[model samples]
Target: MRIIISPAKKMIVDTDSFPPEGLPAFLPRTERLLSALRSMSPAALQALWKCNDAIAALNVERLAAMDLSRSLTPAILSYEGIQYRYMAPTVFEQSQLDYIRTHLRILSGFYGLLRPFDGVTPYRLEMQAKLAVDGCRDLYAFWGGTLAEALAAETNLVVNLASKEYSKAVEPHLPASVRFLTCTFGEEKGGKILEKGTACKMARGQMVRWMAEHGIDRAEDLRNFDGLGYAFSPAHSTESNFVFLKGDT
Candidate 1:
């Protein structure tokens, strides 16, 4: 059955008021990456954080400096940068490396799902890319809305699939317009409202139109939609709705 939502305004999640528990297990490597980064000079790190070029340089530096071919952890770290660009790693010495690489590919491909390329500033994009590598599922969870919320110290909206029980619990509490976030047609190749010109066939114009009819303005307004999980703003009145009709055609 199709579902429609019409939130009067953007549904706000008082992130500070209702913070999530610790990060998920699927995100330990991400944690390690962040921890490792913390050891670097704050000034350098901040520069890197602010400059895309610096971030790219850091990524290149890490891969070149680390011996990924020798161990599982190193290989995983090395693959992190490669995956952000949606490129697969040429080397995989361990099963763990292979596993991590698989996830990275998903993230890179789903890059569009996080935000429209143009809307996400280069610095924010770089930050998200780095955050993706940090074994932080909460960041990965709906394009890291909570993570973003924490970082910006402000409330943020996230969209995810409704199939899970967790979504069910939150659905009723959300505003009517934003009940259903964006629909994910597929993985990696799915819909990413966050990224512009990065939409998949299933999440193309038709989906956007549907959102407009319900309430969604800029494509960037779409946080994430993987068919299974979704999140979006219930405020910013545009259109409110959910679910993709381009299924099993």
Candidate 2:
């Protein structure tokens, strides 16, 4: 089984935590993306990133000096979003780290797909970015079925903890033989499931950490997850989707 999640927008360079195991699987494609990003002017890049002047300037500087094959931080240690912060890989035990390294995958627009320890540089392309390349209109089109094929090659079961944008890269193109299970973290109110972005991010990260700590492999076992006030809702869950709701505690 493989667990797939989204890449965080905010990132940092942390060489001290752990050295990257190796380059990403799609280095050549990433090289092309780098070239295309390099060709864009700062104004255009800022537009693509959809950020304020300071954030855009920072990313612009990063893109200017970015190198795919040089000094790098492990992918799992680079992202600084709330989800990653909650996952807290930096303090993870060695066994938990090993478990995630074997099971977790990060879906990306810049690098395509990344293993937990894959060496990566900071950049600003999202899977849903509108940057067109060659004849492809967007990142999703460029990635196509590549991510799906790679995951299907590795395992027949996929646990999707990623948002719709990143997961679309794989889930839509997956073969029928592969079992794709999605986990939803939300609150049940007035007979409706409402998900707040920040809370869901926290839940996703906590869930990843919990799964790794327990070395969970089977999809059904995930129903036992009760991290961050969430409890599995059998009424809301189906064969392909697992719903966890946070009630008044």
Candidate 3:
């Protein structure tokens, strides 16, 4: 089984920490995108990033200074978001790290797909960003079916922990042979299933840690996931969609 998650916009660079396993598989392609970004003015970059002045300035510097070949932090350690914080990879044992390396993948607009330990530098681009590269109209179009093909090569079963923006890059393009399953973290409130952003992010991370600790390798095994007050709901779940309710019985 393989699991896919989104890369966080918020990142940290630790040049002295864990040695990067290697560069991203899509380095050449990433260079192509970087070429486009390198040409953009700060204002254009700011628009593309859709962020405030401070974030735009930071990313402008990042784009100007990024050297893809340089030594960098592991992809897992670089992303510092709510999900990553809950996953808490910094304290993981070697065995847990091994498990994560084999099963977890981080989807990115810049890198396309990344193994947990892949070397990466800080940059600001989102999967849903409207920036076009080469002949492709958007990041999704630029990535095309490459992400799905990569995932198919790795495993027959894919557990999607990625948000819609990133997952859309792969889900529709997956081969028929691959079995794709998505886990939803939400709560039942007033007869509706309400999904809160931060809570879902936390649950996604917790689920990954729980899976690693329990040596879970099968999709069906996830039904037993009860991390962070979530319990799998048979009524809310389908063969391809596993829904975990946070506060309901």
Q: For residue 230, what is the lDDT in candidate 3?
A: 91
Tell me each candidate's TM-score: 0.23, 0.98, 0.98
Q: By descending TM-score, how would the candidates be arranged?
A: 3, 2, 1
Q: Looking at candidate 1, what is the lDDT of residue 42? A: 44
Give one digit per residue, the lDDT tens place, for model 2 in 66-139.
88888899999989999999999999999999999899999999999999999999988998889898789999
Write model 1 residue lDDT over 1-249, tens digit each, in one string.
122211111011122222222223224343345455546664555554565665556544553354312222221122222112222222223453333222211122112112111111111122232333345433234333432222122112434322232233234444433323444433223433332223332243233333333344333434443232323333322433432322221
88 in model 1: Cα distance from truth in Å?
Answer: 23
lDDT of 3 by residue, 164-220 (tens): 989999999999899999999999988788899999999999988888788789998
> What CA root-mean-square deviation does each model show from the true structure?
18.2, 1.2, 0.9
**Candidate 1: regions farther than 4 A off:** 1-145, 148-180, 186-241, 247-249
Worst 10 residues of 2 by lDDT: 240-249
Off by over 4 Å in 3: none
- lDDT of every model, 2 decimals: 0.30, 0.92, 0.92
